[model samples]
Target: MWGLVAAGLFALTGYLAGSAVGHLGLMGHPLALRTTHCWTTGPSTTSRGGSTGGDWDCTGLAASGGRTHRITATGFTSYPVSMPVRVAQEPWGSWVPVDQGGWNKAGRALSPLVPLALAVTFARWTLISYRGWRNSRRLPTGSSE
Candidate 1:
């Protein structure tokens, strides 16, 4: 029974440690911008000067640019969120962006299983302990019956 209890505790500790390490690894990365764009609007039809060209309607133009741009007009524009990015590590290792919310969601999904495992382990140990106690109580005081 004691051995069972010890093994159960060991397994629980290992799981907790692994979870901590996983979270730490997930957080160790730098945020980065993955994409950008440049839009222009004018009467000139020439697509030169780094401008891609007007769309089918000839009313606007769009070009792939970066957050670092030199705007020369006053018009409605938008910058959408960049694509997900990650930092590269050594020759064979790489660092990927961590989705903390996703990790938390996964943890929540596993929470129920954790308790169930612990309960089963503890119940097994408890049953063994109880059985041993019952057998001891049935033995004669000092006669070894």
Candidate 2:
């Protein structure tokens, strides 16, 4: 009941926060890689009080023209280390050149999930809350029995 509502709210907050930070370039600009190797850290949790959730992060070693650079990516699921990746320049700076194509591709590949997940959460919570409310209304308000 309240837990579902809180979960939905928290999901919405994360969606908004990630979108805002991603746009502001705090996460970094996307860099296309010809070759790379990624090592994913196990999903980690952030808990305060009763809420619990986690995200996966991967560190990639990308080689471009004989130079290798380290890149980090945060995602809901772990990426295949063998797959080529697009990483962004940190808000401060980066060793890799920022690629507009990579940035656009990253946005296209990743942005859809955020809205979809949030929508699903909203729908679930709405349905559960509605059902609970309707059921409560159908119940005897007073001990007429």
Candidate 3:
């Protein structure tokens, strides 16, 4: 039971770490020219089941203003094909400015703490588990001799 709990905790930490790293990667970047790409939606599935319907995937690849010289982002959306999108530039590509408003902004504010939380959780678990192992090793074994 404890092992299963530990496994779940580790998985959670991994997810948090990935999110923190992704957010940090886009820090201090500029927004992209929105009008350069086309936008559309298609059939999508939710995580609960393979049953499709509840989701509409906005799939579109946008190009840079010939600066980076390639398509930078997918799954972006905008009002008109002629208008620029509200996207932030990342090192590898562009990202929708979802973090700029509402609940997403709250999530963005909390993201930087994930790595620290993960590190602390991992260290505490490691030390506790290691001490338990060491104590078990030092215990006397039962035998009839």
Candidate 4:
């Protein structure tokens, strides 16, 4: 049951992420602009208690009007890491003023999807944890004597 739940959740997350990617691309949004890329950085290790070893960072960049704006998300500590995004837009030329509004709007719109994905992931993990607890309670506490 746990496995099934996990698989279902994984599928759902994938679908959501993919949908966001596709939508941003087609909508000519921040995620669709030229030079958009996401990079994650952190040590890859897990503790015995299921805790992560280091901080994780997710950074995305998009360029418009001869300038680049960076959107970054970060996570740390245990599960369900919170990744608040930050945007830094560089001023280049006269085109910068005209493009700023659209870029800012796009960035703001795309921002919520991050938390949505995280919420879905957390729900899935919660389901798995609940199933484990249920199963453990059903099992006998001691060997037959």
Candidate 5:
């Protein structure tokens, strides 16, 4: 019973954490999300921790507050060229432009599974315990006494 409750807590925490990380532009490089400001091109974007998750080479221009910022991100094959991207600027000045397909939003996509898996595990535990108790309560099929 306590295990189930603990799992529920863990699930909620994980989901919330994932959401926060994702929203904070720390999805690609959560472990090494560098905030140190540096120059990549004409003092436009942050230089460090640009692609800590992988060798992401996607580059594009983001319009934030009417100012265009050059950005390199670890998401999407081809960024949307028509609509204005909901860009997330990291503290280091990295720009993460949101795409339509959601390939980059891994945390938002995967976080809820933590709670789901926990719930399933607890459900299995309960089922097994109930079965064990039921079987224990059963007497011998053909008792002579």
Candidate 6:
């Protein structure tokens, strides 16, 4: 029941995402994630947690159109000297930019299928679990077979 509801919500999200762009869920206006290829300006910072490393950040500077912009990557550490940085007026800009976010034609076409797949999987598991529970209830108490 809950799974079906979730499927409906997710399906709606995919549809909205594919049709138009907005600030809401999966509706971010696509932006061409292209700008100056920024190069690292200083040393990166990092922190490690118990098992998984906490986080890393690298600062960079990009020069384009006689203007230099500073950019930072939170989860990126020392490695590539240059990285593509996008400057946008809106915070959600490039949030799901089709060109950069891999929202290809096929992806848009098949987005609705994901919810169906999830619903089927959830229903199957629930049915199997319910049958097992029913069979267990039918067994006499203290029976180990």
What tens digits encode model 2's per-residue C-alpha lDDT throughout 1-145?
5556556666665665555444334564455544333344444455744533343455557665677776665542334343465555433343322223566547644664665566667767778888887887887879443
Prediction-by-prediction clash tally: 0, 2, 3, 0, 0, 1
Q: Which stretches of candidate 6 lie over 4 Å from their true place?
A: 1-105
lDDT of 4 by residue, 31-137 (tens): 32222333335556565546445644444455557777664433312222223222222221101101124674476446556655665676777787888788877
Provide C-alpha RMSD values for all models, in order: 18.2, 11.2, 5.9, 15.4, 11.3, 10.2
Which should have the higher lDDT, number 5 or number 6? Answer: 5
**Model 1 regions more than 4 Å off:** 1-9, 24-97, 102-138, 141-145
Q: Per-residue lDDT for 15-88 in model 1, tens only? A: 55444343334433333423335343544445564644342111112222433322221221222233432222
Output the better candidate (2/4) by lDDT: 2
Best-fitting candidate, measured by TM-score?
3
Query: Model 5: which ten-residue window has the lowest total lDDT?
Result: 30-39
Residues 1-145 of candidate 3 have per-residue lDDT tens digits of 4445555666666655444334433445444444443444554667876754332123344455555433344443334343444445444344444334466656755764665565566667777898888887777787322
- Descending-TM-score candidate ranking: 3, 5, 6, 2, 1, 4
The CA lDDT of each predicted structure is: 0.43, 0.53, 0.49, 0.44, 0.50, 0.46
lDDT of 6 by residue, 1-145 (tens): 6556656756665654544332222343222223333243455354643343333344446454666655543322233333353322223332221222445545655666666677667767767777888999999989995
Scored by Cα lDDT, where does model 6 land? 0.46
Flag clash pairs in model 2.
Answer: 29-88, 29-89
- By TM-score, the better pick of 4 and 6 is 6
Q: Which pairs, if any, clash in model 4? A: none
Off by over 4 Å in 4: 1-100, 143-145
Candidate 1 C-alpha error for residue 64, in Å: 29
